[model samples]
Target: MVVPVPPPPLLASHVAVRAAASAISHGRRVLLNGDHPPQVAALGRGDWVKLICGASFEDAADVRNLSLVYTLAGVDCIDCAADASVVGAVNEGIEVAASIVPTVQRPWLMISVNDDCRDLHFRKAEFDPDDCPLDCSKPCEKVCPADAISLKHSMVDGERTLSDPLRGKYEGGVITERCYGCGRCLPVCPYDRIRAVSYVRDPTMTAELLKRDDVDAIEIHTTGKGTDMFNTLWDNLSGSINNVKLVAVSLPDIGESTVDLMNTIYTIMEPHFKGYNLWQLDGRPMSGDIGRGATRETVSFAAHVASMSERPPGFYQLAGGTNSYTVDYLKKAGLFQSSNWNSGTATSEMASSHQALIGGIAYGGYARKIVGRVLRKIPEQFGRVHIEDHPDHLLEALQEAMSLVGPVKGYIPSHSKPFMKQVDRQ
Candidate 1:
């Protein structure tokens, strides 16, 4: 009997980096995959794009990480260190661009800032030296609710830089890499350097659906807060339809309403509404496209509501999912979208007519309506919290509050292990 030997499997590293003289084909262009030229920074990436090459830029009010290599369509991150020759209009290609930021596992989850902004300073850039009017009374500290901000002066590679409201200075200069892009302090600040990153042209996939002739699929971004708040609001508005028109939603730590609407929608709704949705997702329609607040039933129901109220439902899902991340533009929208029909603009609305109220908000309606439902449930688990309806200026004021006191709360080193036990306790 003769014996034969098999060759060992080759590792990727061991494989030769060879390329033929002929062009290698791709979705459109032929990539050499070897040497690449340097890239020049173009205009800042567009925010909140409505149409990306006639496709879907704002596919979801909040599109979590679909892991789409938009690079195929020439969608590249301004910060992406990838090789150039592979970007831009190589052929009659790339008519649009997606927000080239990284996606989160949960589209609706805001980067739980939890900051306390005070006397934060930019790293290496001395306000006194640059003649920055250098007003450090820093109102941002007084406003941040999450305690994720701070204000401090420190050294970075041996330079005095003021990084504030963060209670700590940048090691060198203002590195956006260190910023959560909350921009809570922008309006209050005297300078232009400190700013949060918001989507440029925040897409409205739902609105796009509204413009179409056929309404088939629909997505609903729900907070696992609960359904009671929504039900109450709906029930109380027994005869009013206008109150559900301009569904104004807000998330916990919005850059401001100036930011996209979707991000704020996730947080503004009472947590009760969010929690109920989550419970129902797990107990009831678990088989449908139900995911927490974004239950398949809820989405379908929202479509039903929309169809009855306005149009048919399409493929809509809650902005929050288990595969999205938050940072820069990619995860920005989830930081805003809300749980209910502030106006049923997206999948958050329902059909309810309130005779006395306007724009779906009525005096004592939301509170009184939702309060009974909360009381009926786990009385031990329920606690009453006062909520304020933010006027546009009020929203700006809160953003200013974030500005005056946001950094001290937001700039925590992701690697820091001090374990903010009290933060969790609260």
Candidate 2:
């Protein structure tokens, strides 16, 4: 008997689109985090939400889809790799999202690069599968969040023996393009085969990408080893510094020296830094997808930085271990938007500014894992499928994105209210 094929995917009706758009506006309008739009009041109100596309995650298709979904969810920025193709993918996704919801704010596009090779975000996992025992169970593949690893075995000569170590060949290894160097797979390899290879991004190419109009921000990942490398990289990009609207420096906690390093870095940027600056307190570093425990380090980092009497001159944001539980953690820590805590070095001015002590949060691995579920449901044949092309998936993805973003923005449930009309766009 022959089976009938399923119907073509249905597009969302105009009414459905309007409802989705209305929900977004309502959510933004009612955000308890602050009364201002996240982009305008993010730093001040501590409600900025940035979608990190992984500094090393170069998957164009995934990046584009994530951009579109998060844009509709109302994030303030989308942080991605510094490559030209990746930037194009992010812009393409943002434009598509705007097309769908016309009034959706165009989030600032930020590119990430590292000054030092030792930084974990600038690495990739590598190993040779040929040396592996055929019978070995692959835990690396199972632990990988990005699905960067693949292995397949086949019987030779259509025969197998218990003693035959070479009975089959492993067909696939790490897909370099998909690997974001999260380092999760490095520890799970029982054979001790997997190792991380680190590299610094080229300054020339980064400067060139900064000149593009679509690019609005730049994140420089530093190892806090010292200011030597950061100074060099900063000087290299000074020529193109005016090209973007904001500059963000991502660094880890190095104890007492952390504040000093931040101050020094700020001094470096102060002369040429015409745009807004933010300090990314990367606590646990790329562990957001692990679980609840991962979020603590970042929250702790924010609290630690918030209490500091001499932090620096810039917005402070949490990263590395951020997840859905982060906002609650921040609220509990009294750092969410407390005006009492002073983080910046300009104590008098900062106190008067009345901006939220902790600016906002950036979601990376955890963000992808949530919406990625719906994206994975789409069939492989529909390569490079725009989330908007499949409105059902787009709406589902938007819902997932909002679940994580809304709480931070103080979104109230619109359970009883009638759907509002869509806003008129310029």
Identify the leading candidate in terms of lDDT: 2
lDDT of 2: 0.82
lDDT of 1 by residue, 1-426 (tens): 888543323223112100100001111122213231111000001111010110111112011111111221122211110112211221101111111111211111110100111101111111221322334554544433112244445555565545433333422323222232333445665555444433211123223322332221111212334434434433332232122212222111112221233323334333323111110011121111222332222333322332333221111222111110111111223221122232222232222311100111000111111222322233334233111111222122222222211121222222232322112211
Please identify model 2 stretches exceeding 4 Å from their true place.
Answer: 1-10, 13-17, 29-40, 154-166, 340-352, 413-426
TM-score quality measure for candidate 1: 0.20
The clash tally of candidate 2 reads 1
- Superposed on all Cα atoms, model 1 deviates from the true structure by an RMSD in Å of 23.3
Write one digit per residue (lDDT tens) for candidate 2, span 255-290.
888999999998888888776788899999888988
Clashing pairs for model 2 are 32-410
Report the error of model 1 at residue 129, Å: 11
